[model samples]
Target: MSLNVLITGGAGYVGSHVVKTLEKSGYFTVVYDNLSTGRADWIPDAELVVGDIGDQAALSRVFKRYSFDAVIHLAARVSAPESIKKPLRYYADNLCGSIALLKQSRKHQIPCFIHASSAAVYGNPGVAPVGENAPLLPINPYGASKMMAERAIMDISGSSDMRWTILRYFNVAGADVKTCVGQRPENPVHLIPKACRAAGLGQDISIFGDDYDTIDGSCVRDYIHVKDLAHIHLLALEYLAGKNPSIVLNCGLGRGSSVKEVLNTAQRVSGKNFTVNRKPRRPGDAPVLVADNALLKKTLNWTPRYQNVSEIIETSWICHQRLTGRRSKN
Candidate 1:
């Protein structure tokens, strides 16, 4: 019998890619999205259900209708600045919704659970390459919500029959190389996609805080290709299916790229000389955050294929141009 996977927030940027990957890998996939930030058109071939994770009635119905062997929970309100402005909203969506989903999953006896966590969980650590064992000092409500959800899963794992893997992502970028899906947030705040859009329109892009302590005096982050991240999810699912131990993995290449560096690469890839305006740093902004993905490689035997910076930028630029109908300068 084939495995059935239920992906919350499956119509969103990263989740959509995971759905497409699962479909290609011959798994029966079902996507549950509220269309709040996700596009309905993204999940065409898979079983798509429009619903909220917080809605117990909706979740219960979906669980009852399908025999999901595993659950990949991605539904959440993921905006650091916005989460600061509306903390209650973040808690409700990120924390409460996850609890509700886990409750429903337990009720249905689903064995595997995979969560999409963020690097914001390690807020402004003095350390360079953060590891899984690093201190989790989240500075914002968005991070707080994800941390809370991770704790909930850990606690549930001790007693419940559910096994889980939590992947803490750092600066997920790039698009599906196959062009099957791409990032389409309602109001995208991610650097690469937003920069691509600005370059496409010949608009001035803002570089938030160029005075941070780094090689270029700008905030540095590790950007991981979305396709690579999706592949990690598939590996985690297979690992869990084999009754492997519950684990937490930091997903990223163990390298740092500054904001100015990203902007330069975007301009080069898009062939557009877009202007950049330096601005004050937003609240809860970290000076630098890079991952130490040694554990992920050692444990899972996983190697990231898209390791080149230019390749990531080019793939993202192509997808942005395709969506916006504005080709980048050659």
Candidate 2:
């Protein structure tokens, strides 16, 4: 028999991808989202519950209704610059809202949890190829919020019959192979999608900083294709159901991409050259952040397929045009 999974924020980018992946593997999913950032059009198959995670009453109703085998929590605010300006909102939405979900999980004895975390929690590790064992010193409120949520998950798992996997994602980019379901236009802060939008529109792309201590003097990030990232989440969910191991892993390609390199790749993939402008560095921007996925490979035996940048950009470009309704190019 297939297990039932509760996926919060299932109508969002990565959450929707996970829902599609899980359904292919024969898992029934129930999506709980308030539609704040998630779009209803994303989850075309699953049953969606329109409610907030902070609404404890709603969570209680859902928990009583469904026999959930796992809870994949993906609902949270995800922006560093915005978090810095509104730390309280980050805590309330990301951290406090997580606590409410954990309470429900514990109340209903949900067996597994796969949390969607971010590499921002590592915040300028001051080391290349940062490992899971590396110190977590988040410099921004968004990172701090993720860290606090992780802590809550751990605290609840230790005392309850719950197994958890926290997947700290690097720069997740690209879209699904088809133009059917990809990121929405309102996605504010992802690098590749924004770049794709610029390339598709024939607008200038902004490289935040050009003086970083990297090969191209631009900020470096470990870009993992969104499809690969979603698979890791599926693997984590399966591992938790079968083995029930508490694991924390970094999801990435164990390499770095400079901002300028990404822009050039975007232009090449789209067959369109957009202007590039370098401005002063954005505050709280890290010079370099790459992942060391040794633990991820050993623990989950996962391998990435989209190791090249052009392929990711190609898919992203298609999705960007689709997102913008194939607008007439300038």
Candidate 3:
């Protein structure tokens, strides 16, 4: 029998791609999302439970209904800038909701948990290629919330039979290679997609800051393709199945790309030029964050298929055209 998995926030950008990967691997998936950011159309193939992650009563009902072998918790308010303005909201939703989920998982006796974490937990690590053991010094509320949630998982798992894999994602970009699913326009805050949409519409894109201590005086990030990250999730599930010890791993390309580099690539891929504006730095913004993905690669025996920044931007450009009904210039 196929393992039944419960994926919270499985309809959002990363969550939807993870659902597709899991379902394609022959696992039965039930996506539980609040639809605040996730759309119903994203996960058309799997079951969906529309509810807030903070709603323990609702989550418990679903947990009682299904014998889930594992739970992939991806549902969280994910905006770093927004989290700075609303710190309590981030803690309540990301931290408290995770606690609730852990409670329900223990109650239901779920064997495994796959958490979608972020490199933001290592805010401004002052070092490139940050490893899993780096001190979690989150500079923003979003990162702090994720860090606390990971701690909650670790503490709970130490006392229970729950096994987990925490994948601390760097910058996740690109879409499915087949163009089946990608980041939607709803609250487009990421750099690549924002640049693609601006280029498509002939609108100007703004760089948050241009005075960081990076190569281009702009922020640098390790942009991993969403498909590659999705594959890591699959590998994470398999690792848990093989009775590997619960582990934390960094997910990225082990390299860095500047913000201006992303904008340039998006323009080149879309075959359109848009104005670029430099704005003051936003709070909680990191100067540079590159992941030391050696653990993830060695642990899961994984390799990324899309290694080029141009290829990653090209896929996002295609997704932008499809979502906006614009013709691709190339």
Candidate 4:
């Protein structure tokens, strides 16, 4: 029997990708989202329930309606700068909302829980390729909210039978293979999509702080393709279903790509010229963050397909043109 997986925030960027990936793997998928940032057109065929994760009454109603075997929690306010400006709102939504979801999970007795965590949890690790044991020093409110929710999960799991896996994602990029879905945010901040759009459409791409301590004086990050990251979730679900112990893993390429490198790759992939504007560093921006993916590899025996930054950019540009009708002739 296929497991019925309840994916929160299934209409959003990464969640939507997971939805498509899950369907491809033959899982019975159900989406629960409030449509705050998620689009209605994202989850086309999946059963989508328009509700907030923080609403216990609404959650109970949904839980009563479906017999979910597991859950993939991806719903949260995910903006770092916005979180800094709206700390209380972020806490209420990300932190409090997760607690509410856990209450419902305990009520439903869901066996497995997969959390979509972010690499921002390690605010500023002293070294690159930080391991899972790295200190959780979140400099921004968004990361703090995630760290706090993780603590809550740990405390709750000590008493409950919920087996959970926390995946701390690095910079997620790219789209589905057929371009069925991709990042469709109105205020896009992710580098790959932004740069790809600019490169193909001749728009201005802002380079944040070209004075960072990196190869090109810009910040370095581990860019993981969305499809590869989606497969990691599937692997985590299988691991949990096999009655394995709950684990925390990082989803990344185990390498680094500077901002300039990414922009150059985007240009090279699309064969277009776009203006690059240097801007001041945003608050709480980490100089470098790459994942030590050895544990993920050894634990799940996972192999990433799109590990190259150029491949990520290429796929993203194709999807961007398909979605926006900005096909470039180069």
Candidate 5:
């Protein structure tokens, strides 16, 4: 029998990709989003409910209406800087909202729950290739909120009947190779998307910090293609189907790329020399955050396809061009 999947925030960048992948895999998919950062047009085929996760009444209605076998919780406040400025709002939206979602899922008796966690949970780790057991010293409120929610989910996992998978993703980049869906947030902050937009608009881009102890004197991050991350989620669901306990996995390529390297790749791919200015590093900015994907690969036998820097930049650049209708140099 096919599974009935409810994807919260399914109209957003990563969630929308997961929705499409699940639909293509023949799952009956339903999208629940408030359209705060998500677009209605992105989720084309799925049944979308424009609602907030914090609203328990609306959540009850949706769960009661659909017999969901699994729930992929992707809706959360994801800005690091904004989270610092509005810590209470981040906790309310990311932590409180997730608590509400978990309670509702328990009431609905969903079998499997997948959460979208972040690599920021490990703030400025002194070691490379950080793992699930790495010390979770989140540097900012956004990461703290996610860690809190993850703890809540784990606590409920034993009492509730639902199994869960907490995937701590690194810098998610690239786009759907088919270009069916791409990163199109109303106010973009991610490095790749922001750079793409700047290149498209012929505007100068800025690197937050340049004195970091990386190879290029800039902060380093592990970039995972969105499609690859979606595939990991599917694999995680399948893994949890036979297990009783909740699982935690880091979703990344286990490789690091410096900020300057990414910008250079974008310039090379687009053949446009967009001006870049180095600025003071923002507060809570980590020098390096790379994932130790050994568990992800060993546990699920998953391998990333779009692990190349050029491929990541090219796909992102193409998607940006398609949306803005501007020709990048190349």
Candidate 6:
């Protein structure tokens, strides 16, 4: 029998891609999501259970019904700026919900657990291309909640037979290479999706800050393509199945792109130009965050295919237009 995997928040952008990849790889997937930011259509082929991760009763029912060999936890609030405004919500969803999931996983005796962490945990690191060993000094409540979640996973796994893999992702952007699964434009919180939407509709794109201590005075990030990030999750699952020890990996391209640079790339790729509105730096904004992906390469023996910013933006632009009922410019 094929191994059954329980994917929390599997209908979201990254989770949907992972579900497709795993399904293609012959794994049976069951998606559990709250439908807050995820859509049911995103995972058409897999079984989807509409529920929140914090609801132990709901999780208990699913665990009893499905014999899950592993659990991939991805459900949580992900907006940094919004987290600052509503910190308690972030804590409740990201931190407490994660602990609840961990409890259920332990009770159910799930052997493998993969967590979706963020580079925000290493907020404003003193070094460029931050590594897995860097100190986690989160600047925002979102990051803090993710950090706490990581700690909880470690604490739980230390006392049990559950092996865990924590993937600390940088700015995950772009669409699937096949353009089937991409980010939705409704209330986009990320920069690339927002930029793609503005370019599609001929509107102004907002630049959060232009006075940061970096190239072009704008914050720098290491935007990894969503497909590439999804591929790594598959690799992590395979590694775990091999009875490998618990590990943490940073997911990125090992380089940085300024916000202005990405805006220019989006315009060029979409064949559209729009005005950039500069605003004061938002709180919880990091100055620069680039991942040191050397460890990931060595561990997973994997390389990202969509390394160019323009290529990534092109796929995103195409998917954005398709979803928004707009024609892509030639």
Clashing pairs in 4: none
TM-score per model over all chains: 0.96, 0.96, 0.96, 0.95, 0.96, 0.97
- Residue-wise lDDT of candidate 4 within 67-98, one digit each (tens)? 99999999998878888899999899889999
Model 2 residue runs over 4 Å out of place are 186-188, 325-330
lDDT of 2 by residue, 1-330 (tens): 378999998988888898998998899999999988777888889999999889999999999999999999999988888888889999998899999999999999998999999899998898989999888899899999999999999998888989999999998888896744747654546778878777766778788889988999999999998889889988888788886679899999999989998988888888888889888988777888999999998888899889877788888887777767744443
Of 4 and 5, the candidate ranking higher by lDDT: 4
lDDT of 3 at 175: 83
**Whole-model Cα lDDT of every candidate shown, in order:** 0.88, 0.87, 0.90, 0.88, 0.87, 0.91
Question: Which has the higher TM-score value, candidate number 1 or candidate number 3?
Answer: 3
- Candidate 6 — which residues are off by over 4 angstroms? 177-179, 326-330
After aligning candidate 6 to the native by TM-score, how far in Å is the CA of 150 from where it should be? 0.4
* Cα error, candidate 2, residue 252 (Å): 0.6
Q: What TM-score does prediction 6 earn?
A: 0.97
Residues 60-81, model 3: lDDT tens digits: 9999899999999999988899
Report clash pairs, candidate 6.
none
- Residue-level lDDT of model 1, residues 1-330, one tens digit each, is 258999999998899989887888889999999988788777788899999889999999999999999999988877898988999999999999999999998888889999999999999988889999999999999999999999998887777889999999998889875563746522457888878877887888898898987999889999998888989988888989999888999999889899999999988988898889999998988899999999999878899989966778888888777766632332
User: Alpha carbon lDDT of residue 175, candidate 4?
Assistant: 81
Give lDDT for model 3. Answer: 0.90
- TM for candidate 1 is 0.96
Off by over 4 Å in 1: 185-187, 326-330
How much is 70 displaced in model 5, in angstroms?
A: 1.0
